[model samples]
Target: MIKLQNVEKVYRTSSIETLALNNINLDVKKKEFISIMGPSGCGKSTLLNIMGLLDAPSKGQIEIDGSKVENYNDKDLAHLRNQKLGFIFQSFHLINDLSVIDNVEIPLLYRSSTAKQRRDLAQEALEKVGLSNRMKHFPKQLSGGQKQRVAIARAIVGKPEIILADEPTGNLDSVMGNEILGILQKLNEDGATIVMVTHDDAMAKKTHRLVRLFDGTQVM
Candidate 1:
């Protein structure tokens, strides 16, 4: 469902150019569960950002579900990203001021869905993440795992085709991390495409395929 060919990402300043990704080539199929493993500063998160359309590659092509994203206008890219990609981050990225349900509803608020419909979808998403009872709670009131689940709920509320998770279990203990991994496995089984970046080898092994990177290049 996603393809990257010779993708190169360079971060530039007035006097320095840092290469974040170098000639990344990958093809992720629909409903596939893929794990990206690498050391710190190895460009794993950079790759995920590019794949999710949050950042553009410097000199390569990115195709999502057959559309060449490099040529897409900002609005088109935003539309496609909202329609096709979901993201879960290590930091959870929840708005502390918003309630769990409100956080989950934020993504759908941009779409044409009515209030009731958005609420219904958000509730369903919360239920999927085992956070239905905590919908009215704020992020600060929840544990780290619960907060991450809320983030996952927000990610899936729109039913995007692909989920890009970066260090999804980074802040959780082993038990809580396992719980989150189980949810992701179930989602994959139910036909959701997932590409997750993790430092844990055990977590990486849980996915169907693994890709390792070194110095911004895919080495395995």
Candidate 2:
């Protein structure tokens, strides 16, 4: 469902040029679970951003669900992202002021769905993550695991085809991290393509395949 060919990402300022990714070639099939493992500065997050269309590569081509996205217009890219991709971040990224249900509904607000439809979809998503009981709670009112579950619910609420998760368990304790991983595994079993960037070797081993990176290049 995703493809990258000879991708290169470079950040350039007046006096500095840093290569974030170099000659990267990757392909993720539909419904597959893939993990990216690398040390700091190895571009795992950069690759995830590129895959999610949050960032563009300096060179090379990206194709998502058979559509070339390297040069897609902003509106087109946003629409594509909304319709095909979901994101989970280490920080949870939930709105502190909104209830969990509202946070999950935020993405749907951009679509043409009615308020009722959004609520239904959001509720279903929360149920999938086992967070239905916490729907009315704010971010600060929930435990770290619960907050991450809410974030996962928010990501999947739109029924996107792929999920890009960056350091999903980075901030959690081992127990909570394992709980989060279990939720991700269940989501993958339900056929959501997941590409996760993680520094934990044990976590990487749990995925179907691992892509190792170093010095901004895929080494395995």
lDDT of 2 at 186: 91
lDDT of 1 by residue, 2-75 (tens): 99999999999999999989999999999999999988999999999999999989999999999988778889
How high is the lDDT of residue 169 in model 2? 96
What is the C-alpha lDDT profile of model 2 across 1-220, one tens digit per residue?
A: 9999999999999999999999999999999999999899999999999999999999999999999986689999999999999999999999999999999999999899999999999999999989899888999999999999999999999999999999999999999999999999999999999999997889889999999999899999
Local lDDT at 149 for model 1: 95
Root mean square deviation (Cα) for candidate 1 = 0.6
Query: Which 10-residue span in candidate 2 carries the lowest summed lDDT?
Result: 196-205
| lDDT, model 2 | 0.95
Clashes of each: 0, 0
Candidate 1 residue pairs in clash (backbone atoms < 3 Å): none
